[model samples]
Target: MRDPNFSHKQMSAPDRLPTRGLPSNSVTPSGRNGVSSRGGEINERIADRIVRVQWDLTNLKDFWKVHSSPHRSERLAEYLNAELKVLEWMPFQAYDQNERVDYLLLKNFLRNQLSEVHRDAELDSKVLAFLGGFFPLRMANMIEARQRVDDLYHKKAAESLVECTKRIILVKELIVSEKETAEPIVALRATKNLEEFKGHWQEWYNFYDGYDPLFSYWISEPYPKLQKALQDLIDTIKKVCLGLETEDEDTIVGEPIGRSGILEALDTEVIPYTPEELISIAQKEYAWCETEMEKAGHALGFQHWRSALEHVKDLYVEPGKQPSLVRDLTREATAYIRKHDSATVPPVCAETIQTFMMSPKAQKMNPFFLGGDEIIVSYPTQTMSHEQKLMSLRGNNIHFARATVFHEMIPGHHLHMHYMARHRPYRQIFETPFCIEGWAFYWEMVLWDSPSWQKTPENRIGMLFWRMHRCARIIFSLKYHLGEMTAEECVELLIDMVGHERATAEGEVRRSVMGDYGPLYQAGYMLGGLQLYALRQEVVENGDWSEKEFHDTFLKANQLNIELFRALILGEELDKDYKSQWKFYEEIKRD
Candidate 1:
């Protein structure tokens, strides 16, 4: 049986307040002297506070060190000041959940401890760490979200590529200390000693975190029709710089960068048919989810509906009552699955159990099972109200259902969790979200494109579906996060570029910008793809290479961003440009 989804909107303001739950004597910070806090100076007091935060984080890491209970992880989020939201809108019962606290709560917490906290940098770092843990899963969701949309305008893709280029320029400007630019990265970099890398890490996080939303907002909310406009502007600039007919100019000028040219390009792109027919096609595709769900023995009557409603409300309203509900619900679902023989347990879940059957190594590792439901994947449909339910479902797709299973459960994310369970020594580093998420994100394309899944026409279609989603994700992310593309423009782009409907496109746009960890969805893929591609190229160029060798080495290595991975494989050092630069950060210097 698919796992039940949870909702956080059911949580009241009072329930979310972090009152009386933490250990009262939690390692008191000894920091003082506003100057030390404001600037990047490392006085004893500031050092002590940083150490305490790290220690507290380490404690949480230790708690999940060798265990396979997503429930326990959910509980950890509560202590860490966060809530979870799961969406159930598809027949495949795809998982989509957001685990995060209110931005206001975090903002206030930072304000209260302003003197000792490098607020922006510190907050960004923590958020990055949190999101990084689930980076790949989120990226898959974003890509799926984009593909489900029915319209396709290539301009959206162009917008994303341009945004990435612009950011590259922005980082280059920062490295060179260009005038009129903020210096968050530089401030963050100031703390990069062995004892202070975490602090320095926050500085880099601060720079990207603040910039991401502003960039996303331009594409998403206020002016939601920016994609075509931005694309046209870019095309116009390209035309002006390197006359339209010149190949050399084309290479030098690159993609479009402005609005007018993109708008004109969008206008000229002909729609294949009526919008109503397009919507109908999308609806039919989405209905497969319901069919699949029923086949898995999901009873979608009033009883299940009522129970779902009651269960979600109680999750936060009566936190005291959650354990019983969770237990009873999980038991009932597990029993139902056993009786029906419809719910297929994944390979990784089985592998985890086998490994933990307790060989001495297994005992030392203490591996265990984490139910599929506990990770809390929110579906695209749950956010809709009664009137919008049909429309919402119509916008959903199963393109990433298989990819999700691979990335979240098998040789990808679940593997990361298994490693965390088996290897307690690296728990502190292991808990870092970027490493976890990055690895999973890296696999979405890797697994989808693998020959194992491409054996038949049906399989090929599935692969294309996934590829389409990835393309859409790239389009939506760039348009929303960087190019300032709007939902309508994004929808039009989807129609023109990938053939997804407008309703689906709008949903993708909303999720890309509005949801927690949304930015990471795009950033993770960009970062992960860059890393995987660069590594494969490095080995291929350096020696007689094999995909099997690359795959095995990648799977066994530290799941951190490209920097650490490149360092291990190629013997190169990298700067914080790990977040950007497509090649290893060291490669940027070489270039």
Candidate 2:
């Protein structure tokens, strides 16, 4: 799975799709004008100006971000900071609550972008530090110089390409004899960067290759030479590196974004909690799940919940039977939600739900369900090893499928996309896990709270297994990012604390950490769900809104940081210098 948090459905599918947000270099389109439009030409709000600034910065980044150019990074950062300074001119206090929410979002969004630019530059420096002087910065400058002026000296471009090729050849030799072995993760990062550099060079060359006679004559012969040298260098480094294992399916090589990186990511997600505090939140959730699991175990005539959990995990629908089971569960969960009026499930969304089997390779990374537009079912197939098959079977048992079917389809991811796609589609740029996976997880909490779906002891344990798993995700994921836990340690925690099968645990940890997810993503499930639950308490339980109305309003609001949404929903007047001060978990704090 390329992205693990992409959830209009999962990040784009469900759990596994908890695809993290856009790439550091990707541009988010600021809506045509204004963040809000009720109908024909609503008055332009300050959000419009802020998004336009994003638009301007996004364009500046387009040309400024020349591969391997520090000036590109520095200039982009300076531009963003200048925009922030420009924002000081806005009359913030005069703005209404909705306008204020946009202002806060834009401010945080800008700051988060700046932090990421810093993180990128820092990571680039670290990775290049291990490059052993093999980097061809002159080539980077050539690329940068070309972008600076549309009319380039074609002959000069060709000369530079020839020179870069010679440099690359020499660099490969230096690497081959290099005594200092780079860290596997850093080496892999360097390898990827080098490849991108190779690509950038090719792109730069091709633009003038045949189009310009002098450029073609000078660059054509040398271009492939440089490309080959880049590849050779990449190959040599991979051979020398520890973590660059391409052969083993089980090898998980993730670059741990230390505490500083984790903190930057959390800020980007608008999560106020420290990684330490978040671990505590996960601990409480784990303890609560434990208490509930015990009651469910006791109901099932077992003294310990682990015994009951194991009992449930062992009960599966045999090989060919899983597909039917998933289909039936999807219908059952859909019907149940509709019957309970838990959320507004349009006929189209329910009727349009689709299912597919996961390939054996995909199953290695995400040995569970994935959802959004379609439900990706992960059950054992003929290709898997017998042991692998057993793990898949146990990991995705009938009750486990029942617990998450709606999560990947219907009222979970499918419904999320169904509503979000139709309403406020522009806001999808701000997609966060809290809304994607969190909303799906929130429904899990909602169903568990009401007690209609998990009628049997087996079902209760099944649901509790996932609930505990989400808690473990937070603790292990944050700890991994904080440099306190290894991927293997995180995997061990899942198997030990959450009763995950070894294969599922490894796949889960691999995708969560090694895949392209932000640091705080795993925490979003329990945290985002809890935030929604807290909001539910305030609105439905304490105030006038009904469950359907509350759910509908939130779904319609699309992807916002849960904190930002809090302001919109509650109509809170933010202080001039606002931060995520919502101690949302405090309302559910237990002694």
TM-score against native, each model = 0.36, 0.85
lDDT of 2 by residue, 528-565 (tens): 99998887786677545678867877787777788777
Clashes of 1: 54
For each candidate, the alpha-carbon lDDT, in order, equals: 0.34, 0.75
Candidate 2 ranges with C-alpha deviation above 4 Å: 1-44, 50-68, 132-134, 144-159, 169-185, 202-217, 246-249, 301-303, 589-591
TM-score of 2: 0.85
Per-model clash counts, in order, read 54, 24
Best by lDDT: 2
Q: Name the 10 consecutive residues with the lowest summed lDDT in model 2.
A: 10-19
